[model samples]
Target: MRIAIDAMGGDFGPRVVIPACIDALTRHPHLSLTLVGQQDEISAYIPSAERQQFADRLTVLHADKVIGNTDKPSHALRQRKQTSMHEALCLVADGHAQACVSAGNTGALMALSRFVLKMLPGIDRPAIITAIPSRKGDSYMLDLGANVDCSAEHLLQFAIMGSVMTQAVAGIAEPKVGLLNVGEEEIKGNEQVKLASRLIKEHGGINYAGFIEGDDICAGKVDVVVCDGFVGNIALKSSEGVARLIGRQLRDGFSGSVFRRLLGWLVKPVLQDIASYIDPARRNGASLLGLQGIVVKSHGGADRQCFGYAIDQAVAEVSMDVPNCINRQLEKSIAIKYRLKRSP
Candidate 1:
């Protein structure tokens, strides 16, 4: 499978993108990569021997322009037609690549993707879905930032999409869907939450697990959490911020005193493993759901390792045929729901 990458979109640009592409090619022999960026800059990162190793498997497309972080989403999409990110997405749209991954301005990515690829049938809006580590394992959260304000119908659609995505990516069967609310009670949240709960409960297509409070997210009470992008974004960022704070405290405590220092040396390996598991850079990337093809959005500040992980994620999505599987599931569920609703 061929994966298209926006090499000039992230903070590290070709320096990290080139190495990560090489690493992915080494590990997955069948994987081909199309780097979208300035050809000269990309060539500088890949040595002659390494280039010869991959040979025709690797190709670089020149994109003289770039989308900056400060540019307005609409303006950038309109002005920077030759941007690396836009060019990479064009590869996917034109069937040149199975998937596209970028660590650029998220707004531009979202806007361009929606405009070029369009939304899936029956989906009102595409959601930004990501896996969040929980006590019971990883849980999927949708509308992470795609839509700041969403209607009850929009949220219900997110629940359906999130449920299918969790099953496809997390290997969960009959994934339980939860509506994020201030309380676990059905009537506790705002008008939107209450209306969404009613629809979810009566929809019969999804495995609705009632309302879930914010605290229940980390507790792993449900496999899929659905909320408006406004709320979901806050929850995701809050969890990430807390994790970083804890990691800093651990580092300081370990080096603060001799006794702690000895303990640190003994448990350093274990701590490192835990930190890696919760690192925002490691889990910061997300997929734009409801599109025709796979599109991964990595953190703008992602390093080489983070970019590598994003490539792995893109490969998984493409290999698993996540979009096809999700579309099939959605069709079956909607069909069943329509028949049931007409019954009695």
Candidate 2:
């Protein structure tokens, strides 16, 4: 499999992205990587020994321009044709690479991806979906800052796409799909959530699990959670904040006294495992679902390891043929629904 990397997209530029690409190449030997960015900057960071080791599997595509973090998506789309992010995505659109990964501006990335790759036949818009650690394992949530305002139909579309993605990428058969709402009762949510629930339940393809509250997300009540981008993004950021707070408090309490410090030492292994599990970097990849081709988005501030995780995500999706799976599932569901509607 071959994947394109936006080497100059993230806050740290090639410093983080280049190492991440190297790490991904080392881990996935069958993979080929094409780093898209300024050739000189990318080459300066990659040591000659490392380059020689993976010479056959690695290639650099020079792109002199870069899309800035704060650049407006509209302006970037029109003016940033020569940017690393745009070119990297172009590689996927042209089928030169199987997938593309970028830690660039979310809005700009989405705009460019949709314009270049186009949405699937039945999909009106592409939703952003990512995995988050949960008690049952990991839960996939969609519309995370992609489409802030969504309709009932959009939410239903998100449910279908999220369910298919979880099943394809995570190896979950019949993944339980949940609508993110304020309450578990069918009558509790607003018009959009309530209607989305009805639509999902009516659709036989998904394993609809009714409504799930915010707390249920961490408890792992469902494998897939669907919501508008506004709510999903807020929930994601808030959960991240709480995780940081708890981690900090635990560290401070553990160092408060000799006895506590000793206790901390005793539980050091357990704590380390928990820390790694909740680490955002480990879950750095978010898919731009509903697109015709596969595109993975990494956190703009992600480190080398985090960015590498994003690359891994792109590889997994490419290997699993996630976009094609979603297309097939969606077409099947629509066919079933059409038949049902025509029946007495």
Candidate 3:
């Protein structure tokens, strides 16, 4: 399958994206890539031998413009069609590419995706969903800065979409779904969270796991966590901060004394394993769920390896036909609810 890359979008531009693409190509021989950006700049990072090696699998789509980090989503939508990000997404919309991955402006990515791909039939809004590292395993969380303000119905939609994503991408069967609330009790939380819980419990085709508090997120109480974009975004950022803090404290403690340093030396391999497990680079991709097409977003500041992780997600989702799975599951859910409503 062909995957489009916004080569000009990230903090380091093609310097990071090109190497990531090469790494992905090395790992996935079946993958074809279309690097979108100024041809000269992108080609500078790719040596002739490397180009020759992947000639059949790599292509470059020249885009004269780029959407900047500070550009408003609305302005980007109205005036940035010739940009690398926009053209990359267009390739997916036109079916020339199976998926598109970008480390560009998050708001701009979400806006362009909605405009280019449209929403799924039963989905009213698109959500940003990503896998968060958990004790038992990784749990998928949705609405991560996509739609800040959401309704009860929107949260329900996010639950179903997130559930399908976890099942399709994570390969979980009947993935347990939960609402991100302040408390585990059904009576807790505001009107929206409570109503969303009620809807999910009453609906079919979903494994509703009831309310999960913020502390339960990483504990792996559920496979999928649903919340408004405002809450999800904050939770994601806070977790990132805590991860960094823990990493720093561990480093400081390990290097503080000769004895501790000796101990660290003996456990270097184990520490590396633990660090890799918690590193944000290892889990860089966030899915733009509820879109008709597949789009993956990488952190704007992601490095080459981190960006590769994003590409890996896009590749897996494309191979799994995540969008089709979500659409089918949603159709079944709507039918089930309709039948329930019609029943005596």
State the lDDT of candidate 3 residue by residue for 214-320, as single tens digits. 99999989999999999999999999888888888888889978999999899889988888787767899999999989999999999988999999999999999
Every candidate's lDDT: 0.89, 0.92, 0.92
List runs of model 1 lying over 4 Å from the truth.
none
Best by lDDT: 3
Q: How accurate is candidate 3 locally (lDDT)?
A: 0.92
Candidate 1 lDDT over 103-194, as tens digits, reads 88999999889887778887878899988888898888988988999999898889888888877777888999999999986659899889
Report the backbone clash tally of model 3: 0
Q: What TM-score fits each model?
A: 0.96, 0.98, 0.98
Ranking by lDDT: 3, 2, 1
Q: Can you write out model 2's per-residue Cα lDDT over 97-203, one digit (the tens) per residue?
A: 99999999999999999999999988999999999889989999988999999998899889999999998889999899989999998789898888888888888
The local distance difference test score of model 1 is 0.89
Candidate 2: TM-score? 0.98
